[model samples]
Target: MVENPLETETLARLYLAQGHPEKALPIFEKLLSREPDRLSIRESLARCRDEVSRAGREAAVNEKKRLRILERMLARLTGSTPPEEEIPAAPAIQPPRPGAVERRLAVLKQMLQRLERSR
Candidate 1:
């Protein structure tokens, strides 16, 4: 039955003050959506998002670096190739006829000239 918006804002602020930023974020965002011009509420919400994103990004970077360093150290200590997918050997190639390669090259050059003239 509270008629005052400030009272609701105060309660949301209390939640934030208690280190329950996640709990407070939705309330603040809802109120801000109802009154989008409230700069103070918008700023608080932005701060919360920025902190969360920075923490997430830093954790991702640390994890990536840890894996990279471990891979390098493992390669160095073993002095052996790390487990890798085997590349299937290509089938042996027969030498092409002299005119065959020349014809392909000529066709490619003609295509290039046509592309250049179009541009």
Candidate 2:
């Protein structure tokens, strides 16, 4: 059965709204391929691609942050300091609270020590 273009476009938009651009990407691509002159479809395709790219960059940044946190925790456990270059600088717009890093490190160290004792 032939699918209605309007229905397909609506489905694609729903996927985009639900934060699943990956799913919407193919649908938009299909719509655009069938209706290359349709400006709305073309715009939706561009938006979907941009969303996918943005999500990828965000995931990479989050992964880096998680790795840095883990490295810091490991360094604390081993009584060694992580290299200065490995530490990320605080965002300029929102300065970190004084002693915040130290407090967090201390709490992490206590938790690690307790975990070691439990083992």
Candidate 3:
């Protein structure tokens, strides 16, 4: 039976070499906290953190693109308006007041009487 190796530094380096930087991140971070003077470990931790951030940004962009594609496909399947066809928000309009409505009716009646007199 082979005993499993449990060296934290070795395991961290192994994770880095295996392109699993995210997995190595916390290990290096803890190791750095313990050995703050270790420049190599600090650099490794920084690199891992940068890689993780870049990956997160790339994933977010990919998710946005995937959602856009899915939205277009759903619009096509359901015969709904596409994103590009989305209408601008309508402007707010106040309802006509009773006095304003009555004023307009009176003006229209005056115009009608003038039209009849002209005829």
Candidate 4:
């Protein structure tokens, strides 16, 4: 029962193409460990790590923006002053994917709905 390196590489690339770099990273790491001299695998591993790092940063930024929006919405509901800083312009957001903004907006809407129901 031998695992084919080419098959493993194909699986890793599939994960990357599907936008699951986190899943792909460990596979690349394992592949690199077994064949450290493969330049192409090394490069792919580096790229996977970069994508994972970028995704984490983007998530953090989006979480902050979501919290800010929620805080303002709550303040308005409670008749308190909203935060002094305005929500940044829409163009300021640099999402990693085309559907990221839509997904965030959907989550925010659900949060707002829950808040309203609690009142």
Q: For this target, which candidate reaches the highest lDDT against the unseen true structure?
A: 4
Least well predicted 10-residue stretch by lDDT in candidate 1 = 1-10
For model 2, the stretches where C-alpha displacement exceeds 4 angstroms are 1-7, 85-119
What TM-score would each prediction reach against the true structure?
A: 0.41, 0.64, 0.62, 0.66
Highest TM-score: which candidate? 4
lDDT, candidate 2, 1-119, per-residue tens: 57666649999999999999999999898888889999999999999999999999999999988888888889989999874555567777966799999999999999999999999
Better of 1 and 3 by lDDT: 3
Winner of 1 and 2 under TM-score: 2
What are the Cα lDDT values of the candidates?
0.78, 0.90, 0.85, 0.91
Candidate numbers, best lDDT first, in rank order = 4, 2, 3, 1
In order, how many clashes per candidate? 0, 0, 0, 0
* Model 4 segments more than 4 A misplaced: 1-7, 86-119
Position 3, candidate 4: lDDT: 64
Error of 4 at 115 (Å): 67
lDDT of 4 by residue, 1-119 (tens): 67666659889999999999998998898899889999999999999999999999999999988998999999999999998886457676664798888999999999999999999
